[model samples]
Target: MFPASKQAIGMDLPAGMTLLLTLGVSGLILYLSIRTSWIWRHLPPGPTPLPLLGNIMEIGRSDVANSLKKFSDKYGEVFTIYLGSRPVVVVTGYKQVKEVYLDKADDFLGRGDLPAWNNFYKSQGVIFTDVLEWWRELRGFSISSLRDLGFGKSGTEDGIQEEAHCLVEELKKTKESFIDPQLCLRKAVCNINLSTMFGNRHEYEDKDLVVVLSCIQNTFAAANSSWVQEKANPNSVFTRSHLLSSALQIFFAGVETTSTTLYYSLLILLKYPDICAKFQKEIDHVIGPNRCSTIKDKSSMPYTEALIHEIHRFIDLLPLGVPRKTVREVTLKGYKIPQGINILPLLSSVLKDPTCFKYPAEFNPENFLNEKGEFQKNGAYMPFAAGKRNCLGEPMARMMLFLFLTTIFQNFDLKSSVPFEELDITPLVSGFGNLPRNYKCAFITR
Candidate 1:
């Protein structure tokens, strides 16, 4: 019906052909770009993630502490890595970490909020809230209440003395080392925290207490440094993501860290017989025979006080510590890290900074004591962290540590099954907090 040229032209699909051509070209470009692997190119170089799964696949189910340490060794202090599309910036060493924690403290005040937390944690816990102003206010209130409840003074020391007696009694029940020392320490310290927090002393065998502690412990394994690393968002604290992180954060951060710290201190003291002897002699000389170590005696026993400080510094609990998010976009080390980038303050690294401490690797109390034999405070010795967000339970933890140590030593001669080096200082690969490996010792009656 049409002319020969017109009929032939009609066969050429103009619009459809052009659309098809454009789509084809775009698809090719996207495929090339994705296949190019830009994470390696743009991100800080370290572990190369496989497609889809990321570094998580390669690392398997390793504890957060060991994996990060491994990465730190390969990458310089502030290398960036990815976990399932999430960007993680690792900051090792004292100087770089201090900059983020202290210098840009204002910017790095927020906690991380992650997806799994919201899905699971019910997300109303105090620590996970995204509101900084409210958080500081509440944290301050809680700390004040805790202080009023006998935290740093002789008021709480009385409670600690009672708990230590129970611990010694519990150990006496186990003549031979057949028990999980974990259970003993956990039960003992758990009771102390319960009494301190709620003014109730539930029996050690209380099923409810065990269940609650277990819930917190299991949650800690899942939601520790990795959660902080993942959330890394100050605003998220208001959201469910951070609520879960914060709720679980407090229980684990407070009880487990403090308790494990005590466990290690005991282990170290038990292993170093000569050190224990020196500590005991100092305590005896300072506070007379038979009187348990009290908060009042802290000034008199400078060596004992230094010993406790040294234990905290040397154990270096929580290698990665807590990850602090930038509240505002700030310039750090000439790099403009946009708000919400993960900033880790290696509190342990600072505690062991070579320039700050005499023997970075060795356990020495002299680092804490000066020529006048007074307890010298250094910025580097930050177990509770530093600045406005320093640990709320610091006063409580210090009091408990001192009282617990003094009580146990006052009653028994502690000894470890393994030698000092042989004893496992290696934390269980859980998260930032280095949980002590399972080991045992005898609590010989003094």
Candidate 2:
């Protein structure tokens, strides 16, 4: 019914609408940019970031700890970086890390939301839970339970000693053949946790043990499922799922970090045989050849103790301690951080700080030794981290490291398959934790 001119004009309406939509999008982007600028203006300074992407390109494909060190050098110890659209404040150096985690512990006690962990835990478990009361109760219960189970007590040493013997027997089976020690070490370490937790240890060939290990390895993969459906129910505290989730967290944490540390210690010793000789001499003097080493012998074996501390320092295991969130607004180093800002207490930065250690980059046992050669504790040595939310398995892990290393070194002389120079001590994977590259070593019975 309309005229031909009107029909022609109606056809142009679609084009006009398209143009309006484009303008609206542009305005929205502009507003967002301004908002982002305003938000960042108050935070600590760091590298400039592109809108939406925000420093992802800068941090690409590099070890995050190393990358963060580079940023810390440029932006000072306290600086901010964007992980996608979210701003993460990185606190480096021992002074600053201690200030946030120790001095103002209560202010920085909240847990940051990690997508992968949230999918698995649904805000449950001591490691990832934000429920303050629940975290306190569970943490207390766990510590008490561990103590009751003879963790760090004389009663548990026999079990660890027995496991060490089992490990030695297994290694002896290798009979001088070049073998990658990863699987054996993993099993030994895992079995210790299993024995402690469930009062059962598995043989090397146990299919159930294999299945459990596989599940742990694939935890991040399985996290995306709807297994945490009970999270929505208000009355579901300490439910069956919660118990399993907590157990899984403890098992994974107890096994992976301890085993990886042992692996690194062996690799480092192989690289510096002179250091190894010194370590063995100290061990021989203190523990002798006939009997297994116990935790009580640690005081007399200062060099061996120093070597273990150096391995932890040199390896810089966790690198970035689990990300923390500000429970409320906090003022750190004169910079105001609002509630819910994700914080990374860069433990690697502190571990490698030149002010704290003589040779931060090199693997030196003297870092922990005084001029008199007695083991001196450094305040900066926080391999298990510090404060209220520090690693729950610290006592157990320390015991295992000392017992396992001393037992193995006492019974066998570790020899690398390749020349010392050919050995690669660099981490094969450096995300979440540092994992040493796989290599063959000969465990010759002494």
Candidate 3:
């Protein structure tokens, strides 16, 4: 009788445990559903989010750009999307982007939530800081100091010209053999910033230069800039940590974007040899091969300028510009967005908007050219993004693109074994950058 009773008890315990486990899961699902609904109750309508998971599945891991486009099409220009339970207000189209970023710039000056960057930077850098005053001081100091040193001006042209000459010499070593240009171009572009910041540039083979390049790729860069060290203000935001972070921001953001653009420009030119020939023609007529290219020459070479602008538009390097957060509650397009909600300015939509460009989807330099073949500015052209918080490196990047490209073409002609039709120019979209696919091409001396 005792043995039978023990068996009965064991059987009942197992049944009870199974029922309890089922109820616990169901209760958790209910709680999450209610919480998610309450969180996004007043936000703009968007794709339904699942409990715990949010809309990550719908957003898809790799197709975030396309997902945002699809959501905007269904929910209108201003819509909401969940990135792992965090609601991001995605603003698309030029009209809506301009309104949110430009019209309400002050209200949305707060840095948006970026979990990865936030964790690493700990809100120390200018790019990721939510402390508005600190960001202003650093930004002001950086711009003024860099400008004084000739960044984005003729002051830096001699350095760039020297580096471009080195690049041509390096490519000349390839002896017209197909070689990867990524390393050579990256080093050359990075040297421009290094020379400005450190007052010296490294030889391409220098061990320290390799280390610095590695650091830049891994969310860090050297910060021995004289400006940062010269101004000692222990009480101010110019602490060692903050200054180092800012320098890292400049190198990482500036070098990667500029080099990738130059790489894409080469790829695009390789794909369109006729355009390449035209660039050479313009370079010959305006600057000529004997002299180094300068910022002033940009005015005389409309075709070259137009092509570079088209590259920026065509590549859409950063489809979604750095996210911004609402500093205060603001009403936009009849939607009442609460303060602190993350905002994603869909730059790709604006860059590719049908109304903005005649050939927005294709690589056509005519987008920035008139019937007279002179470069013309388009209001929709916001490749570096629009508003006050747009890329601080814009001037430097523009200068580099013009100088590096003109110098390269002036010295060497692009030769690729890949047939024009077979050559793929589509950008390989990474997390935040649209990278050109790896290919080998020869640089024959012109």
Candidate that would win on TM-score: 3
lDDT of 1 by residue, 253-295 (tens): 6678778888888777766778899888876677655666678
The whole-model C-alpha lDDT of candidate 3 against the native structure comes to 0.84
- Candidate 3 regions with alpha-carbon error over 4 angstroms: 1-13, 217-235
* Cα lDDT of model 2 by residue, 120-239, tens digit: 689887788887777886788668867887888886888899999999999999997889898899899988987876678899878866676777635433542443446766775555
lDDT of 3 by residue, 53-167 (tens): 7788887456467778988889999988887778899999998888877888998888888888888888877788878888788889888877887887666888888898998
lDDT of each: 0.69, 0.85, 0.84
Q: Decide which is better by TM-score, 1 or 2.
A: 2
- TM-score, cand. 1: 0.76
Better of 2 and 3 by TM-score: 3
Candidate with maximal lDDT: 2
Q: Write the candidate numbers in order of decreasing lDDT.
A: 2, 3, 1
